[model samples]
Target: MTNASTGQMTPATSGVLLVLAHPALERSRANRALAKAAKGLSGVTFKDLYEIYPDFVIDIESEQAALSAHDVVALQFPLYWYSTPALMKEWLDLVWLHGFAYGEGGEALKGKKLFVACTTGAGAKAYHAHGYNRFSMDEFLRPLEQTAHLCGMVWEAPFVVHGAAVKDDAALKAEAERYRARVASLLPAKTEA
Candidate 1:
Protein backbone atom coordinates (compact mmCIF):
# COMPACT_ATOMS: atom_id res chain seq x y z
CA MET A 1 0.00 0.00 0.00
CA THR A 2 1.04 3.62 -0.49
CA ASN A 3 1.38 6.11 2.32
CA ALA A 4 -1.08 8.90 1.61
CA SER A 5 1.06 11.67 3.09
CA THR A 6 4.53 10.38 2.37
CA GLY A 7 3.76 9.48 -1.25
CA GLN A 8 5.81 6.32 -0.81
CA MET A 9 4.95 2.67 -1.11
CA THR A 10 4.76 0.49 1.99
CA PRO A 11 4.50 -3.24 2.37
CA ALA A 12 1.31 -4.60 0.83
CA THR A 13 1.24 -7.64 3.06
CA SER A 14 1.14 -6.44 6.67
CA GLY A 15 -0.69 -9.54 8.06
CA VAL A 16 -2.96 -7.17 9.93
CA LEU A 17 -6.68 -6.96 9.19
CA LEU A 18 -8.88 -4.26 10.63
CA VAL A 19 -12.62 -4.77 10.25
CA LEU A 20 -14.69 -1.67 10.95
CA ALA A 21 -18.39 -1.69 11.79
CA HIS A 22 -20.46 1.44 11.90
CA PRO A 23 -24.00 1.72 10.65
CA ALA A 24 -23.76 5.42 9.95
CA LEU A 25 -20.14 6.38 9.61
CA GLU A 26 -20.60 9.83 8.13
CA ARG A 27 -22.50 10.93 11.22
CA SER A 28 -19.72 9.86 13.57
CA ARG A 29 -16.77 12.20 14.04
CA ALA A 30 -14.65 9.94 16.16
CA ASN A 31 -15.19 6.85 14.09
CA ARG A 32 -14.61 8.64 10.80
CA ALA A 33 -11.32 10.09 12.03
CA LEU A 34 -10.22 6.77 13.41
CA ALA A 35 -11.13 5.06 10.15
CA LYS A 36 -9.10 7.57 8.18
CA ALA A 37 -6.12 7.07 10.44
CA ALA A 38 -6.37 3.31 10.19
CA LYS A 39 -6.64 3.40 6.40
CA GLY A 40 -3.60 5.65 6.12
CA LEU A 41 -1.32 3.41 8.09
CA SER A 42 1.14 1.08 6.39
CA GLY A 43 0.91 -2.72 6.59
CA VAL A 44 -2.77 -2.92 7.35
CA THR A 45 -5.87 -4.05 5.47
CA PHE A 46 -8.98 -2.03 6.32
CA LYS A 47 -12.49 -3.25 5.63
CA ASP A 48 -15.69 -1.40 6.39
CA LEU A 49 -18.50 -3.81 7.01
CA TYR A 50 -21.33 -1.36 6.53
CA GLU A 51 -19.85 -0.05 3.33
CA ILE A 52 -19.26 -3.48 1.88
CA TYR A 53 -22.46 -5.11 3.07
CA PRO A 54 -24.96 -2.31 2.93
CA ASP A 55 -27.70 -4.77 2.17
CA PHE A 56 -26.63 -6.85 5.17
CA VAL A 57 -25.76 -9.71 2.86
CA ILE A 58 -22.19 -10.77 3.57
CA ASP A 59 -19.97 -12.86 1.33
CA ILE A 60 -18.86 -15.63 3.62
CA GLU A 61 -16.03 -17.00 1.53
CA SER A 62 -14.48 -13.59 0.97
CA GLU A 63 -14.69 -12.65 4.62
CA GLN A 64 -13.21 -15.94 5.70
CA ALA A 65 -10.39 -15.58 3.21
CA ALA A 66 -9.55 -12.14 4.56
CA LEU A 67 -9.45 -13.47 8.09
CA SER A 68 -7.31 -16.42 7.06
CA ALA A 69 -4.86 -14.12 5.34
CA HIS A 70 -4.11 -12.05 8.42
CA ASP A 71 -2.43 -12.88 11.72
CA VAL A 72 -3.93 -10.05 13.77
CA VAL A 73 -7.59 -9.06 13.53
CA ALA A 74 -8.78 -5.75 14.90
CA LEU A 75 -12.47 -4.98 15.27
CA GLN A 76 -13.28 -1.27 15.27
CA PHE A 77 -16.67 0.20 16.02
CA PRO A 78 -18.72 2.51 18.18
CA LEU A 79 -20.31 0.86 21.16
CA TYR A 80 -24.05 0.51 20.53
CA TRP A 81 -26.28 -0.42 23.47
CA TYR A 82 -23.18 -1.75 25.22
CA SER A 83 -22.46 -4.08 22.28
CA THR A 84 -21.36 -4.01 18.70
CA PRO A 85 -23.52 -2.61 15.93
CA ALA A 86 -26.15 -4.92 14.47
CA LEU A 87 -24.21 -5.62 11.28
CA MET A 88 -21.12 -6.55 13.21
CA LYS A 89 -23.10 -9.01 15.25
CA GLU A 90 -24.55 -10.42 12.06
CA TRP A 91 -21.11 -10.66 10.52
CA LEU A 92 -19.90 -12.57 13.53
CA ASP A 93 -22.82 -14.96 13.46
CA LEU A 94 -22.51 -15.66 9.75
CA VAL A 95 -18.77 -15.63 9.14
CA TRP A 96 -17.58 -17.25 12.37
CA LEU A 97 -19.20 -20.60 11.79
CA HIS A 98 -18.86 -23.66 14.00
CA GLY A 99 -16.68 -25.63 11.61
CA PHE A 100 -14.61 -22.61 10.61
CA ALA A 101 -14.00 -21.03 13.99
CA TYR A 102 -14.44 -23.47 16.88
CA GLY A 103 -15.08 -27.08 15.97
CA GLU A 104 -13.33 -29.84 14.02
CA GLY A 105 -11.18 -28.28 11.30
CA GLY A 106 -11.90 -24.89 12.82
CA GLU A 107 -8.36 -23.88 13.72
CA ALA A 108 -8.03 -21.03 11.29
CA LEU A 109 -7.87 -18.40 13.99
CA LYS A 110 -5.88 -20.47 16.47
CA GLY A 111 -2.78 -18.79 17.83
CA LYS A 112 -3.79 -15.55 16.16
CA LYS A 113 -4.67 -12.35 18.00
CA LEU A 114 -7.98 -10.46 18.38
CA PHE A 115 -8.22 -6.86 19.43
CA VAL A 116 -11.11 -4.46 19.92
CA ALA A 117 -10.98 -0.74 19.30
CA CYS A 118 -14.24 0.91 20.30
CA THR A 119 -15.62 4.32 21.12
CA THR A 120 -18.30 4.97 23.69
CA GLY A 121 -20.61 7.94 24.05
CA ALA A 122 -20.42 7.84 27.82
CA GLY A 123 -17.39 8.82 29.85
CA ALA A 124 -15.18 6.25 31.53
CA LYS A 125 -16.80 6.96 34.86
CA ALA A 126 -20.14 5.82 33.49
CA TYR A 127 -18.82 2.28 33.13
CA HIS A 128 -18.12 1.76 36.83
CA ALA A 129 -20.14 -0.28 39.32
CA HIS A 130 -21.60 2.84 40.91
CA GLY A 131 -21.75 4.78 37.70
CA TYR A 132 -24.67 5.11 35.31
CA ASN A 133 -23.84 1.94 33.38
CA ARG A 134 -23.05 -0.05 36.54
CA PHE A 135 -20.36 -2.17 34.88
CA SER A 136 -16.77 -1.85 33.79
CA MET A 137 -15.65 -1.82 30.18
CA ASP A 138 -14.01 -5.17 30.76
CA GLU A 139 -17.30 -6.58 31.93
CA PHE A 140 -19.06 -5.32 28.84
CA LEU A 141 -16.29 -6.79 26.72
CA ARG A 142 -16.26 -10.24 28.28
CA PRO A 143 -18.14 -11.85 25.38
CA LEU A 144 -15.50 -10.85 22.88
CA GLU A 145 -12.69 -12.00 25.14
CA GLN A 146 -14.43 -15.31 25.55
CA THR A 147 -14.86 -15.59 21.84
CA ALA A 148 -11.12 -15.21 21.38
CA HIS A 149 -10.47 -17.79 24.07
CA LEU A 150 -12.87 -20.21 22.49
CA CYS A 151 -11.17 -19.79 19.13
CA GLY A 152 -7.75 -20.31 20.70
CA MET A 153 -6.75 -16.79 19.88
CA VAL A 154 -4.95 -14.35 22.12
CA TRP A 155 -7.00 -11.39 23.32
CA GLU A 156 -5.18 -8.11 23.52
CA ALA A 157 -6.20 -5.30 25.81
CA PRO A 158 -8.78 -3.13 24.09
CA PHE A 159 -8.34 0.45 22.94
CA VAL A 160 -11.27 2.50 24.15
CA VAL A 161 -12.34 6.09 23.71
CA HIS A 162 -14.83 7.35 26.26
CA GLY A 163 -17.17 10.29 25.62
CA ALA A 164 -16.89 9.71 21.93
CA ALA A 165 -19.60 12.18 21.07
CA VAL A 166 -18.15 15.04 23.06
CA LYS A 167 -14.43 15.03 22.41
CA ASP A 168 -12.85 18.28 21.29
CA ASP A 169 -10.94 18.49 18.07
CA ALA A 170 -7.55 18.12 19.73
CA ALA A 171 -8.64 15.20 21.83
CA LEU A 172 -10.18 13.49 18.81
CA LYS A 173 -7.02 13.95 16.76
CA ALA A 174 -4.90 12.57 19.57
CA GLU A 175 -7.20 9.56 19.85
CA ALA A 176 -6.90 8.92 16.12
CA GLU A 177 -3.11 9.01 16.31
CA ARG A 178 -3.17 6.76 19.34
CA TYR A 179 -5.39 4.31 17.49
CA ARG A 180 -3.15 4.28 14.43
CA ALA A 181 -0.12 3.68 16.61
CA ARG A 182 -1.81 0.86 18.49
CA VAL A 183 -2.88 -0.92 15.30
CA ALA A 184 0.49 -0.38 13.67
CA SER A 185 2.18 -1.97 16.67
CA LEU A 186 0.32 -5.19 15.90
CA LEU A 187 1.91 -5.54 12.46
CA PRO A 188 4.55 -8.21 12.12
CA ALA A 189 8.05 -6.87 12.33
CA LYS A 190 9.94 -6.69 9.05
CA THR A 191 12.94 -8.93 8.54
CA GLU A 192 16.46 -7.70 7.77
CA ALA A 193 16.76 -9.77 4.62
Candidate 2:
Protein backbone atom coordinates (compact mmCIF):
# COMPACT_ATOMS: atom_id res chain seq x y z
CA MET A 1 0.00 0.00 0.00
CA THR A 2 1.16 3.49 -0.70
CA ASN A 3 1.77 5.76 2.24
CA ALA A 4 -0.70 8.65 2.28
CA SER A 5 1.78 11.24 3.39
CA THR A 6 4.70 10.27 1.15
CA GLY A 7 2.72 8.71 -1.69
CA GLN A 8 5.30 5.96 -1.78
CA MET A 9 4.42 2.32 -2.18
CA THR A 10 5.34 0.23 0.84
CA PRO A 11 8.26 -2.06 0.13
CA ALA A 12 6.71 -5.46 0.67
CA THR A 13 8.58 -8.11 -1.26
CA SER A 14 6.94 -11.20 0.22
CA GLY A 15 3.40 -10.25 1.34
CA VAL A 16 1.27 -11.23 4.39
CA LEU A 17 0.89 -14.43 6.37
CA LEU A 18 -2.34 -14.61 8.38
CA VAL A 19 -2.10 -17.24 11.10
CA LEU A 20 -5.47 -18.28 12.51
CA ALA A 21 -5.75 -19.97 15.90
CA HIS A 22 -9.11 -21.00 17.29
CA PRO A 23 -9.50 -24.01 19.55
CA ALA A 24 -13.00 -24.66 18.26
CA LEU A 25 -13.37 -23.17 14.83
CA GLU A 26 -16.78 -24.63 14.20
CA ARG A 27 -18.18 -23.13 17.38
CA SER A 28 -16.83 -19.63 16.89
CA ARG A 29 -19.16 -17.57 14.69
CA ALA A 30 -17.09 -14.41 14.76
CA ASN A 31 -13.78 -16.05 14.02
CA ARG A 32 -15.37 -18.09 11.25
CA ALA A 33 -16.75 -14.99 9.60
CA LEU A 34 -13.48 -13.16 9.92
CA ALA A 35 -11.47 -16.03 8.49
CA LYS A 36 -13.87 -16.47 5.61
CA ALA A 37 -13.50 -12.82 4.77
CA ALA A 38 -9.73 -13.10 4.53
CA LYS A 39 -9.62 -16.39 2.63
CA GLY A 40 -8.93 -15.37 -0.98
CA LEU A 41 -7.17 -12.07 -0.88
CA SER A 42 -4.17 -11.61 -3.15
CA GLY A 43 -0.75 -11.41 -1.48
CA VAL A 44 -2.10 -13.07 1.64
CA THR A 45 -1.53 -16.57 2.99
CA PHE A 46 -4.10 -18.00 5.40
CA LYS A 47 -3.05 -20.75 7.81
CA ASP A 48 -5.07 -22.44 10.54
CA LEU A 49 -2.84 -23.43 13.45
CA TYR A 50 -5.22 -25.87 15.12
CA GLU A 51 -5.89 -27.55 11.82
CA ILE A 52 -2.18 -27.83 11.10
CA TYR A 53 -1.03 -29.03 14.54
CA PRO A 54 -3.80 -30.79 16.42
CA ASP A 55 -1.21 -32.66 18.45
CA PHE A 56 0.21 -29.33 19.71
CA VAL A 57 3.57 -30.11 18.21
CA ILE A 58 4.65 -27.12 16.13
CA ASP A 59 7.18 -27.28 13.30
CA ILE A 60 9.53 -24.53 14.27
CA GLU A 61 11.62 -24.61 11.09
CA SER A 62 8.56 -24.52 8.85
CA GLU A 63 6.96 -21.76 10.89
CA GLN A 64 10.12 -19.70 10.77
CA ALA A 65 10.36 -20.26 7.03
CA ALA A 66 6.82 -19.04 6.60
CA LEU A 67 7.61 -15.99 8.67
CA SER A 68 10.68 -15.31 6.59
CA ALA A 69 8.62 -15.45 3.42
CA HIS A 70 6.13 -12.88 4.62
CA ASP A 71 6.65 -9.17 5.00
CA VAL A 72 3.74 -8.99 7.41
CA VAL A 73 2.46 -11.51 9.94
CA ALA A 74 -1.11 -11.28 11.08
CA LEU A 75 -2.34 -13.25 14.09
CA GLN A 76 -6.06 -13.98 14.02
CA PHE A 77 -7.80 -15.58 16.98
CA PRO A 78 -10.60 -15.41 19.50
CA LEU A 79 -9.68 -13.86 22.81
CA TYR A 80 -9.69 -16.55 25.50
CA TRP A 81 -9.37 -15.67 29.18
CA TYR A 82 -7.69 -12.40 28.14
CA SER A 83 -4.95 -14.27 26.23
CA THR A 84 -4.40 -16.36 23.13
CA PRO A 85 -5.28 -20.03 22.73
CA ALA A 86 -2.83 -22.62 24.04
CA LEU A 87 -1.71 -23.63 20.57
CA MET A 88 -1.01 -20.08 19.56
CA LYS A 89 1.07 -19.57 22.67
CA GLU A 90 2.85 -22.81 21.93
CA TRP A 91 3.55 -21.71 18.40
CA LEU A 92 5.08 -18.48 19.65
CA ASP A 93 7.26 -20.15 22.23
CA LEU A 94 8.47 -22.78 19.81
CA VAL A 95 8.89 -20.77 16.62
CA TRP A 96 10.23 -17.53 18.02
CA LEU A 97 13.46 -18.92 19.39
CA HIS A 98 16.25 -16.90 20.96
CA GLY A 99 18.75 -17.20 18.13
CA PHE A 100 16.12 -16.79 15.42
CA ALA A 101 13.58 -14.27 16.70
CA TYR A 102 15.51 -12.48 19.46
CA GLY A 103 18.87 -12.25 21.27
CA GLU A 104 22.16 -11.96 19.36
CA GLY A 105 22.11 -12.65 15.59
CA GLY A 106 18.29 -12.55 15.69
CA GLU A 107 17.74 -10.08 12.90
CA ALA A 108 15.49 -12.26 10.76
CA LEU A 109 12.32 -10.33 11.64
CA LYS A 110 13.86 -6.89 12.01
CA GLY A 111 11.85 -5.13 9.31
CA LYS A 112 8.74 -7.28 9.26
CA LYS A 113 5.36 -6.12 10.51
CA LEU A 114 3.13 -7.80 13.09
CA PHE A 115 -0.61 -7.32 13.00
CA VAL A 116 -3.27 -8.75 15.32
CA ALA A 117 -6.94 -9.36 14.63
CA CYS A 118 -9.06 -10.65 17.49
CA THR A 119 -12.69 -11.28 18.34
CA THR A 120 -13.99 -10.63 21.81
CA GLY A 121 -17.21 -11.77 23.44
CA ALA A 122 -17.61 -8.60 25.42
CA GLY A 123 -18.70 -5.36 23.79
CA ALA A 124 -16.31 -2.47 23.24
CA LYS A 125 -17.69 -0.56 26.16
CA ALA A 126 -16.84 -3.44 28.46
CA TYR A 127 -13.11 -3.07 27.77
CA HIS A 128 -12.33 0.08 29.64
CA ALA A 129 -11.22 1.26 33.07
CA HIS A 130 -14.79 1.70 34.32
CA GLY A 131 -16.19 -1.11 32.19
CA TYR A 132 -16.93 -4.71 33.03
CA ASN A 133 -13.76 -6.25 31.61
CA ARG A 134 -11.73 -3.45 33.23
CA PHE A 135 -9.06 -3.03 30.55
CA SER A 136 -8.89 -1.92 26.94
CA MET A 137 -8.05 -4.43 24.26
CA ASP A 138 -4.73 -2.66 23.68
CA GLU A 139 -3.90 -3.13 27.34
CA PHE A 140 -4.70 -6.83 27.11
CA LEU A 141 -2.46 -7.05 24.03
CA ARG A 142 0.61 -5.54 25.60
CA PRO A 143 2.47 -8.81 25.60
CA LEU A 144 1.99 -9.18 21.87
CA GLU A 145 3.20 -5.64 21.30
CA GLN A 146 6.27 -6.37 23.34
CA THR A 147 6.83 -9.56 21.44
CA ALA A 148 6.90 -7.61 18.19
CA HIS A 149 9.30 -5.14 19.77
CA LEU A 150 11.66 -7.88 20.85
CA CYS A 151 11.51 -9.45 17.39
CA GLY A 152 12.22 -6.06 15.80
CA MET A 153 8.93 -6.14 13.93
CA VAL A 154 6.71 -3.14 13.55
CA TRP A 155 3.58 -3.58 15.63
CA GLU A 156 0.50 -2.44 13.81
CA ALA A 157 -2.65 -1.27 15.56
CA PRO A 158 -4.88 -4.27 16.10
CA PHE A 159 -8.22 -4.86 14.42
CA VAL A 160 -10.82 -6.01 16.92
CA VAL A 161 -14.35 -7.32 16.53
CA HIS A 162 -16.12 -6.95 19.85
CA GLY A 163 -19.51 -8.25 21.00
CA ALA A 164 -19.03 -11.11 18.58
CA ALA A 165 -21.28 -13.57 20.37
CA VAL A 166 -24.29 -11.30 20.29
CA LYS A 167 -23.84 -9.67 16.92
CA ASP A 168 -26.64 -10.28 14.49
CA ASP A 169 -26.01 -11.72 11.04
CA ALA A 170 -25.93 -8.32 9.34
CA ALA A 171 -23.57 -6.85 11.89
CA LEU A 172 -21.29 -9.85 11.62
CA LYS A 173 -21.17 -9.57 7.85
CA ALA A 174 -20.35 -5.89 8.09
CA GLU A 175 -17.57 -6.65 10.50
CA ALA A 176 -16.27 -9.28 8.15
CA GLU A 177 -16.20 -6.81 5.30
CA ARG A 178 -14.34 -4.38 7.48
CA TYR A 179 -11.82 -7.07 8.26
CA ARG A 180 -11.32 -7.88 4.59
CA ALA A 181 -10.70 -4.27 3.78
CA ARG A 182 -8.27 -3.87 6.62
CA VAL A 183 -6.25 -6.89 5.56
CA ALA A 184 -6.30 -5.86 1.92
CA SER A 185 -5.14 -2.39 2.77
CA LEU A 186 -1.94 -3.79 4.15
CA LEU A 187 -0.88 -5.08 0.77
CA PRO A 188 1.77 -3.16 -1.07
CA ALA A 189 1.06 -1.54 -4.40
CA LYS A 190 2.05 -3.44 -7.47
CA THR A 191 5.47 -2.68 -8.86
CA GLU A 192 7.05 -3.71 -12.17
CA ALA A 193 9.17 -6.83 -11.97
List TM-scores for all candidates, in order: 0.92, 0.92
Q: After superposition, how far is residue 77 of candidate 2 from its true place, in Å?
A: 0.5
Off by over 4 Å in 1: 1-14
lDDT per residue, candidate 1, 1-193, as tens digits? 5677798886444467999999999999999999899878766889999999999999999998888878899999999999999999999999998989998989888888999999999999999999999999999999999999999999999999999999999999999999889988898887643
Candidate 2 colliding pairs: 1-187, 1-188
Looking at model 1, the pairs that clash are none
lDDT of 2 by residue, 1-193 (tens): 5667888985545778999999999999989999999878989988999999999999899899888878889999999999899999999999999989999988778889999999998899999999999999999999999999999999999999998999999999999999999989887666664
Write down the lDDT of every candidate, Cα atoms only: 0.91, 0.91
The per-candidate count of clashes, in order, stands at: 0, 2
Q: What is the lDDT of residue 181 in candidate 2?
A: 93
